[model samples]
Target: MLVSNVYRPMVFGCRADEPLVEVARWMVDNEVGALAVIDGELVTGIITERDLVGALATSDDPASQQAAAYASTQIRTAELEEDAREVARRMLDAGIRHLPVQDRGRVVGMVSMRDLLALETWTA
Candidate 1:
């Protein structure tokens, strides 16, 4: 199945200037591990629970840290029409749990590692 068939539509996102604390709050509220960082409808990067943890680990004041500090380098992404297994492999090789799904230059969804695993079991 293609990524669009199984990708999660409930995208969690943040802007560059959004504080880390706010990012953490959104993650908590959404019960998700990551958030896509968007700049005017384009996905610029992603921030994850691990990113927050890493920032906290490196700094004494995570609460004061900016979301941009923990935001990941721009990632390789998949189109919603790409195969699910292909996207899963890309995420696995990159050591990331989330893949932002873009359509015509705009993010439309996300596929998490858990979502892929779930798909595997369902198909099996």
Candidate 2:
């Protein structure tokens, strides 16, 4: 299966400078575990639930920090046409749960480990 077939088309995101609290709220409201941190039109980083939790635990004022501070700047991406299995392998190697799906350098969607696991169960 291709990443485009399994990835969620809705890419929830926020600006890099946005407050962690606001980003967390957006994640909660959207019921998403990860969010793409954007610098203008470019995807600068990715912030996940784990990152938020870590920030909350370590920071005295989590709300004062920006999403960029907690986000993983070295984003590991999966192309839209890439095989789902390949994407899963990349995610595993990178030790990440989520990946932004790109098509011709533009972010089109997001794929998570959960999504890949669901695909495995469905195929089985």
Candidate 3:
């Protein structure tokens, strides 16, 4: 199946300098693992649950930290028309669970390992 068949188009995001606490709270409230770090129309990075844990682990004051400080800046992206399996393989090779889904250089959504696995499970 294509990524478009598996991924939703709701791209939840925040500014690069958004507070880490607020980032985590948004994830919790939305039941998501990552948030795209958006600056205008650009996706600067992605901040995940793992990033939050690392930030909290190392910070003396987690609340004072910003999402951009811990986000994965070397972003691995999946095109909206790409195959789900191809995207999943790329993610595994990069050792990442979350990837921004882009179309025409604009981030349209996100795809996660969990989303791909669920698709696999359903297809099987």
Candidate 4:
């Protein structure tokens, strides 16, 4: 199966300049674990639940911090056309739970480890 087959098509995101508190609220409201940090039309980084937690632990005032400050700029991504198994391997090797799916330099979706495991169970 391809990554596009199991990835969530609806990509949720927030501007890099957005406040961390607002981004956290968006995450809670949307019930999502991560969000793409976009600057202009470019996907500069990603902010995950772990990132938020870290910010909460370290920052004296997380609300004043920008989302980009907490985002992981060196992100590992998966291509839409990539094989599901390969993507899963990459995720495991990198010790990451979420991967942004890109197509021709544009982020199209996201895939979680849970999604891959669920798909594996379903196919099995």
Best by TM-score: 3
Question: lDDT (CA) for every model shown?
Answer: 0.85, 0.93, 0.91, 0.92
Clashing pairs in 3: none
lDDT of 3 by residue, 43-81 (tens): 888999999999989999999998889998898888988
Model 1 per-residue lDDT tens digits across residues 2-75: 89888887667899778899999989998999898877766678999999999889989988888778899677
Cα distance off (Å), candidate 2, residue 29: 1.1
What TM-score does candidate 4 reach? Answer: 0.95
Q: With candidate 3 superimposed using the best TM-score fit, by how many Å does residue 45's alpha carbon deviate from the native?
A: 0.7
For model 4, what is the alpha-carbon lDDT of residue 20? 91
Worst 10 residues of 4 by lDDT: 99-108
TM-score of 2: 0.95
> What C-alpha root-mean-square deviation, in Å, does candidate 4 show against the real structure?
1.0
Candidate 4 whole-model C-alpha lDDT, 0 to 1: 0.92
In angstroms, the error of model 4 at 69 is 0.4
Ranking by lDDT: 2, 4, 3, 1
Expressed as tens digits, the lDDT of each residue in 1-124 for candidate 2 is 9998899997789999999999999999988999999998888999999999999999999989999999999988889899999889988987899999989988889999999999999998
Question: Residue-wise lDDT of candidate 4 within 1-124, one digit each (tens)?
Answer: 9998999987799999999989999999998899999999888899999999999999999889999999999988899899999999989999898999989877889999999999899999
RMSDs, each prediction? 1.3, 0.9, 0.9, 1.0
